[model samples]
Target: MSLVLDNVSYRYPGSTHGLHEVSLDVRAGELVAVIGPSGSGKSTLLKLVSGLTTGHTGRIVFGGQDMSAMPVHQRRMGMVFQNYALFPHLSVLDNVAYGLKLRKVPVAERHRRAQELLGIVGLSGYAQRGIGQLSGGQQQRVALARALAIDPQALLLDEPLSALDASVRGHLRDEIRAIQQRFGATTLLVTHDQEEALVMADRVAMLKDGRLLQIATPRELYEQPASRAVAEFVGLSTILPCTVCAPGRVDLGFAELHAHTGSRPVGTVLHAMVRPEHVRADPAPGSVNRLQGRTGAQRYLGALTRYDFEVPGAGKPFLAESARPAAEAIAIAPEHIRLLDL
Candidate 1:
């Protein structure tokens, strides 16, 4: 079912930190990931949609039905929490079947469905195991199965994979996406991890200071961010203050560079943003947009090395990532320079 939030605003009684006039549309069978730093309203937005919190302004519609005032149970939303929230006292099978049991499904039928869901989550053999007996990954699988047991209209995941180890998190992230697709469930995933949002979401919504900043596909969000904040938050970027000097060109005080400025009037102040990957280290001789800079700091990431290239006269170092350490200079492609408002 399609979920829509229209001009939603909520304020805490005595605190200023809450969502404000935020609106989003999550298409049916589409996965939209909400990403932001702590206290950015990602969780608050999820809670509003899940009917966990109330007294908000504007409308929330799900499948063409007004759900803003609906109770939690009536929302028919399945939630998988960060902690897994599995019942320690109950067996895995019972945990999965608990939701169905609350709805008064026949014991035999719920068991059949629970067993089938366990098989779907690759936990068929662990059904009778106590929650304490299962690994964290396995426990998470059980939590997912429990959420799916109810055949929900929409699935809400609150940092579902954050508690697991890196390897387990990656594996389960893929698994969750696969299962979400298999069931064709409309999903809203709240995450503080930008990589998780970029990897799993069809579109990512960025929030800051309890407000919606931008929402776009991963590629668009990364390559063509709407503002300086979005660009900085989504990935490693070097944002230099510049003034539009001419069509397809900008002046960065220290140097003049060719860049795409679209139709921005000349002399308009903007920030030139470029990702680390787009910055070329040790470029070919006579390359366009080449600059002389000393390498300051080097970080050896597993697959690539990140170099902090300290350009003369530029206030901050331009981050560049390459397979090997950088030399004394770097180049940024003109086309890769994204212009954003100050």
Candidate 2:
């Protein structure tokens, strides 16, 4: 089974654009995350997949059938929202069994299936408790159980853990991954949270202005982003302006460094991006691209320290960070220079 979008795009009748020529394929039993800014159309893509909206251009194919032609209910998709969406008056067991009941499963069989799912989600003992009595984490487990009761063809999550407290969200994130693995259901998660996407997805599809920027594994997305927009959006990057001086080498005011800018004509102005952790302080002499900066301040972020430095050679100071929380930054000589591209 597969969920595929072939040049699918949508726009409000009079609006400019929603999604632009987006295409992707999620194989069975894989978890795909769609992440972007608030208005980047992640939610809108979810709606189209779940059959909540139609009449758009291009084709949305699910299990070899066009989804736009199918009714929402017949699509066999399970949706979980940020809110648990459980009925307050209903017991956890009853809430988990709601979808099964609607499908006319036998009462005994429904309870049997619901109990099994609850166990898988680690909420076995709280099945009969009222929704009001369960904590937010427990409520979310109940919601997961309910979604699984029908053995949905595809699981769709819309900002699934956004409502929970930080600690609870962490616990649920692991649980969600476990549940997805256990069920082997194709899943699509819609979220604006970059950490969630990076941690949860088998592959992440980054969006911007309703367009798919890049889709790749977490490692690929972080290490080899396709464009500047992607490089900045996916992680912390220090953008440096540079003039291409020669093949594989560029000059920053401090020194010249080696780089790979891929066949750009000479004299082209370009920017070089390096992850914060890649920027080192106090390098040795003959370093690739060494520049001196002032030790502005250090901020301890639990496990790492963010270093603020003033690059004197460059008119505007640049930022660098490190995992160690030293009172002062490492001393860099000419050898510690990494690259001179900007």
Return the top candidate by TM-score. Answer: 1
lDDT: worst 10-residue window of model 1: 320-329
How does model 1 fare in lDDT? 0.93
What TM-score quantifies how close candidate 2 is to the native fold? 0.92
lDDT of each: 0.93, 0.81
Error of 1 at 196 (Å): 0.7
Across 176-272, the per-residue lDDT of candidate 2 in tens digits comes to 9989988899999998778888998999999999999899998888877777788778877666677678876666655556677468666767766
Local accuracy of candidate 1 as per-residue lDDT tens digits, 219-329: 999988998889888988899999999998899999889998989999999999988998888888888999997999989999998989999999999988889766777
Error of 1 at 253 (Å): 1.1
Can you tell me which runs of candidate 1 are displaced by over 4 Å? none
- The alpha-carbon lDDT assigned to residue 155 of candidate 2 equals 97
